[model samples]
Target: MATQNEVIFRLARSSRSVPRARALAHAVLSSWGVSQGTLEAAELVLSELVTNALRVRVPSDRQVGVRIARSLEDGLLRLEVSDAGSGRPEVRVPEDDETGGRGLLLVEALAHRWGVEERTGGIGKTVWAELKAPDIVAEPVGREVAAVLVRPGQWVRVWGEWRAVRTVDTGPYAAGGLAVVLGLDDGSALRVNAAEPLTVWNGGSSSAREGGEDEPG
Candidate 1:
């Protein structure tokens, strides 16, 4: 009964402020009478986006922008977080002891579609996730497909069954696309169409790497 629309907000980047983003989502979608399941999915996606923005992007005096919108073309709702950092996000299969890599994985699993792109006229990236209405029929889950863009000559490790181990680099290009990797711990490895080989590098501090670079190949 209600028309699809968009809502946008800007706020400071802080772990403490993450809940505000979720509250805004619940408040705006309440008018649409979205189901509990849809609300949960929306909240989860919002949390992932905001968390990544706060953790990965260096907070500045300027506020991070959060945008909630509906796509009339597909009848889908999208949640986006844009920050002032040049980093991008990768959906990585984290180790059992790793404390942080799972956020993007949850986003990938819960949202119908999610992605990141460079922001215009700034040194930042905009991460987004989309979901259809709860009443909409769900799509069958199949082999997972993850697109990973690795820089040329950068090394990446693929975690999976011993027989399927792979290492690749993009040679001369700093960006690789659709590179596949698996979560050996969870027994789920999506098949990726590797457009370029990944370059390998020594393990470094957790906070040093930016964007999707932290992900396993």
Candidate 2:
């Protein structure tokens, strides 16, 4: 059973529209309770696709199209950027000193999978990418939860949604405990106790366990 949600934005062929597209994607994904890491990847992927679309030489009246869709059950976030131009985007190796031409490279690095497709009844094409959702699970009792440390770049469940830790505070205010700040895709921040039972990925291994107490509220 796959649950689907989608949002579309039609943007003018302007560089300014790229950030707006990313902002809209951030808001929609936040509302869907997507993990912060996934949201960040999705937003970057969306920006690249939209930026590429805007760079294509299209008619002034032909607007760029951005569609962000999520399949909750499949744990996939799909992003599509459509344009009215004729040529498809290709990845080219960029020189180190060059200031441009790395958009698709960034997309390839961030997205789980990405490709191009021709738009139906349109003169241009749609470039799409899919990002895998963050791994979040319950903590195992006794041994596993005792050894883990909450660190930046780790994902933790907060308020029933998984969020990436942006910063960790271990000052006197924490009373020997730790405080963590989470970052949303839209640049918003959330603060939570590091002692809370939040799931953390164990390196690149195949398991995730609780890093703190038992089941956060």
Candidate 3:
């Protein structure tokens, strides 16, 4: 059964309506305080799904259905973009400097998890994505021992003992852990752990270069 937190939008399966669909998604996600990074990823996912729908399906007067649901169990957001098309979703590989065949791959990379579902009582499919809330932080060398890195517009998760530099001024983050900045030749390395999981949603300015995921937690 659907809960009160869920938001559903139905639109015509056309290129012009794509922006409206994204706006609805953003509005729904905003109530949850979803981070900006996550919002961008969500928008991309919606675009891919809608574009595929328009490309493969016949033009119809019926409105396409888009559903955004929040799972109360784990604070994971679920997105379902459904269409009235009769064909199944497929990703074609491109040769040379091709621009196609990479949409689903991008979705897989950005979304924590995703899948497809056949619509009931009609011919259609829903591409879905589940993103975990940004709550867990990666700390340096502490009991938490797990860390998440936000690199230039990317999110990487890892686990290990965090270490810091001797000269670098470690701010309040040192006590919590160091926010390691990557891609620098400052001859310094700092480590931090579990500093609010470095939310990529609303943080405007870049804090530091993202350290690579050393190991899985």
Tens-digit lDDT string for candidate 1 (15-114): 5556666765775566556678888899889988888887764755545778777655576888988888776788899899988789988998999989
For residue 201, model 1's alpha carbon misses the true position, in angstroms, by 50
User: For each candidate, what TM-score against the reference?
Assistant: 0.58, 0.60, 0.56
User: Best TM-score goes to which candidate?
Assistant: 2
Q: Model 3 Cα displacement at 85 (Å)?
A: 1.6
Native-referenced Cα lDDT, model 3: 0.53
Quantify all predictions' global Cα lDDT against the true fold.
0.58, 0.63, 0.53
Ranking by lDDT: 2, 1, 3
Q: Residues 1-217, candidate 2, lDDT per residue (tens digit)?
A: 1232555546666666766666566656765777788888888889889888878887876877777777656878789988888877899999999999999999999999999999998778999999997442222211122112566545444343333354555433255665555553224566555555554432221121123111111
Best by lDDT: 2
Residue 134 CA displacement from its true place in model 3, Å: 4.3
